[model samples]
Target chain A: MGRWEPNARGRLEQAALELYVERGYEQTTVAEIAGRAGLTERTFFRHFADKREVLFAGAGTLRDDLVSAAAQAPPGAPPIDVVATALAAVAAPFQGRLESVRRRQSVIEANAELKERELIKLASLSAALAETLRERGVAEPAASLAAEAGIGVFKVAFGRWVGEPGGGEFARIVREAVDELKAVAAGS
Target chain B: MGRWEPNARGRLEQAALELYVERGYEQTTVAEIAGRAGLTERTFFRHFADKREVLFAGAGTLRDDLVSAAAQAPPGAPPIDVVATALAAVAAPFQGRLESVRRRQSVIEANAELKERELIKLASLSAALAETLRERGVAEPAASLAAEAGIGVFKVAFGRWVGEPGGGEFARIVREAVDELKAVAAGS
Candidate 1:
């Protein structure tokens, strides 16, 4: 392989997901992922720490985007609205990648350990959002509540999107989920 | 030891928590937990499958209580209200167990594996609540949204209750948390 591989990280992720889907996650190996990507194991390590990291590496970037979007929302808006808007904004990246996202979800769902890792990532994202809300002058309980509830909306919305056969818009589903949560909270 | 030990289960739980808090969850062994409770390893195994089970055994009963309360909620109430009412009802069990709950929380917090286990338990509880809401005739996204949001409220409320210097009523805290979440969702 050449010293410079364009989109090596992307290729590794694609390869890893394909392999995980083909051969069960437990049976898949890092060497197989690297070889499938047409890259060396050393290059794979450069992109991800382990086989599991291939599935979760995007979570860090997603959290950063969410926090950034939340931090930049209108100052006087309600914490929940800020979080909702941020969540909607962050849904853009997943718009055109429905199949890959669905594949990733299936892989994660098939493995107990991956499912736990996904939950931990979601929990950490909620914590980060809460911290960002606090930074925005939102008080405790409210900030935490908004952050967690917002994530709850995302989880439901994302699940719905993945389960949809037509592959609808991600942000639209998120908006609807947020509205549903708001109505649910209002006891309507 | 006598063939019959009164409150063997309770004693094992108490001993496990103390040992986990004192010597750390990683360093504590099943043998030590049994010894601390004046029981044998056989007794410990009979009560719990393993050391982690000592901390998580109550989750099953808690889930049952929450699901039953949710199922019995007024037929005409909104999904979120049903969930909130059930959550408050379940808080009754933890009213006088603040110290032990806080210790367990600390122990779980100190260990990554335990924290992941705790997250899995919470996820399972949310799934159960969602299922109960579905059985109550609530629709798809709405059922999941209410259940997840309810769990989010519980997480924040329980955190506040545990963090308080002078312990407050768990049910009251849950109600207040539910109200705060409602206000947040309403963009107040």
Candidate 2:
């Protein structure tokens, strides 16, 4: 293999997901995952810290991307709109990855530790989004409130998108979720 | 000590918080907590599964109470209003316990595992609230949206209450937080 094998990370992820689905997350070993990917154990370690890390690595990137997106939103946009713009940016990457996302979610749901980690990731994302909003001159409770509301909308929309894959566009679902969140908040 | 001691559970909780605040959650032991409470280790186990449980016991009670309050909300109340009523119910118990609550929060904030548990508890509360809303003829997305919004408001209000203990009443803070949540959701 060359020093830089193309898509090595993607192959490892694909292999890990398939093994997790076929053999259950608890029973699947890193060696089996690497073998399935036609790569060495070292290659697997190179991509992820452990088996669970493969499922969570994207969360870190997602958090960072989301923070940057919110920070770069227009100078005077409303806080919620800024958050919506940030979340909407993430929908494109998820368009063709529905199956993998579903399988990954199932695996996470099956494990308590993974579920805790998922919640932690989401909480961290909310905190980061709040910090970004604060940077935009938003004040205390409002900044946190808007960021958290954004996360709530994203979570509800993501669940809907995963369960009803072809029902509507992910971005559209997110918009509607935000609107619903607003309506719910408005007690309408 | 008498076997039928009054408020044994409350005594154990108070002792646990004192120990956690003084010695730190990691260094504190169940035996010490029981000792401070003038109880035996067996008595401690009767009330809590472990040392961590001392701080989290109220979560179960809070969940139960919130769900019951939602279920008992006046008929035809909006889903969000039902949630607001449920949250307002919790504010009563929280009064006169600000010091203990502050200590408990500090301990939880000091430990990552405790923080995760806290988030899990809040998420569970949200889920239970959603189910109660569903039982009240509320439909999908709305139930969850209102429930999640309630949680968001509760967290923000709780933070503000803790940070500024003498600022105002908990229920009033919660009300303002809910209004702010509505404003944020509305992109105000």
Candidate 3:
């Protein structure tokens, strides 16, 4: 549903990841990242609050898209169903960037701070999803249940897509995971 | 399933809460907390890893209990049902400390770091639940689904309990939440 900053963001991310791989998240300087991308540190700082934020900048956009997608879903749809669609709507962005996504995951998984940031991001997203459900008139526990369940689906499917053979097509795994959640809930 | 060092932990917790309320989490030093509790800083550190640990010492133990309880549920029980039972296992401890729990929640809700710790604890508990399901021979995705759904129930019920007029007992709300999840999953 969105991009971070069009071409500039993409360039910074690519340059940053390359340096992080060659060096490391801790070793890579923001200035060097900007220099490698043929951009100034001022440009990098303008886009990212910190070096770590380069990896997390998309989270805000994703949250916004999720809210919009949930709003645009068919009226009165079940919470999980609406959340599933919202997740699906964001899948296309990942499809073309599977390699980069995996690279980002690799970097985050290796750093405790990045991992904490990810957990915080996930928690906020779950809360946002719940808010969407509440706005749709779903009651307390059910809205929370659906939201957490949606986050669960997202978490597991993302993990699988990262590790599964030829699983870079995130949309398919996400759809399958949603179906699996339903089947499991149906006590399959 | 386990007592938190009998009355010492609870007493210390109450004392700590009082200090936090009167002062604040940041301003209240360990010495002040110990003085309020009639204990020493060494005693406090023995029970908790750090200042923040006092707010979270029960969660790890609680998560282990929940996972063990779920794993031991009847073979024929649905995974979600098993998770519900596991979650309900804490009803006794929670009920006994409803007021204290509410006080803790208020303290925690007022702090970002505490909330992050809570989210991380919940995430870890969710992962543990999934692992237990897998051990019970539940298939991939099913285990994850049951775990996530269980967490959903726990969060909803916990919120409902916290909102009760006189501060609700944890068990009753959890039981009701389990039923609510069952109802929603059944599309009732």
Candidate 4:
């Protein structure tokens, strides 16, 4: 939010990933990344606040997409459906980019610290979803439960969408996942 | 697993919460906690791995309860229902302890590091749930999805139960949460 530098952001992300792969998240330094990006340390700061920021820097964009989609869903939509639509909207950027998604997940997997941060990010998203549902007049506990359930579905769908060979469409997989939840809840 | 000292374990937990509330999680140390509990730091380590563990050092018991319950759910139980039943069994020890829970939650809320650790713990629980679901013939994504959704219901119910002055019951709230998910799935 401070200094607005467009190209530096992408440059920093790529640089961070390269270093993370070659060295490690802990071993990678902001200064080293900025140098690789042909930018000064301050320039790197202009985009990401810290080394960890490079990993989660796009969370805001995804969060906004999720919230906006939920907001735009039809008036009578249930909380889970609204969250599903939001996840679909957010999946567009990652769709067909399995290699990148896998790499990001790999980085997160190699370190428990990174995994904890990722978990916190997911928790925050669920909280946001619950808040949005509450704003829509959903009752206590339902809004939060529905939001958490939706995130669970998203986690499952995304993991499959990225891990499977020639993975099916991201949106399609998510829709099917939702239907599966419905079936489980209804059928059993 | 180290010292088979049950009362010592309880003492360490009580001391940790007192200090965390008095000083802070980061500021508190294993030695200080042990001293307060009239034990050596070695005894504290013998009971729990470290300072952070004092809060949920009972995870081993909780896990056993969950696994045993999941192992025993009716063979034909649905994925969500199975997970829900397991969660209910695991939450039994936590019943009638709302005041203690609210205090623990406050300590967690005050510390980001603690919250992060809590998230990691939840992720582990979710993975365990997925594994248990696999033993029941649930497919890959379905197993993970059902597990995560079950965690969702647990979180929502636990959140409400602890916050309510006279929450009906932990198991009751959990069932209510599952019912809400069913209603949402069928609602829109």
- TM-scores of all candidate predictions against the true structure: 0.98, 0.96, 0.92, 0.92
Instruction: Give the CA lDDT, 0 to 100, for residue A67 in model 2.
Output: 90
- Per-residue lDDT tens digits of candidate 1, residues A70-184? 9999998899889989999999899999999999999999989999999999999999999999999999889999999999999999999999999899999999899999888
Stronger candidate by lDDT (1 vs 3) = 1
All candidates in order of TM-score, best leading: 1, 2, 4, 3
Please state the Cα-based DockQ of model 2 relative to the true two-chain complex: 0.79
Sort candidate 4 into its docking category: medium
Best by lDDT: 1
Question: Model 2 in CAPRI terms: which quality?
Answer: medium
lDDT of each: 0.93, 0.87, 0.81, 0.81
lDDT tens digits by residue: candidate 4, B1-188: 35555588778778888888889878888889999988888888777877777777766677777778987999988887888789888877788777667778889999898889777778788898889889878887778877888888888888888888786678877887888878877764
Supply the TM-score of chain A against the true chain A for every candidate structure. 0.96, 0.95, 0.92, 0.90
Models sorted by DockQ, best on top = 1, 2, 4, 3
Report the C-alpha lDDT of model 2 over A34-64, residue by residue, as the tens digit: 9998888998888788998999889888998
Per-residue C-alpha lDDT of model 3 across residues A152-187, encoded as one tens digit per residue = 788888998888777667877887887887777676
Show how many residue pairs clash in every candidate, following the order shown.
0, 0, 0, 0
Task: Report iRMS values in order.
Answer: 0.7, 1.1, 2.0, 1.7
The C-alpha local distance difference test score for the whole of candidate 2 amounts to 0.87
Q: Give the range of the ten consecutive residues with the poorest summed lDDT in model 4 chain A.
A: A1-10
- Model 2 TM-score on a 0 to 1 scale: 0.96
- Model 2, residue pairs in steric clash: none
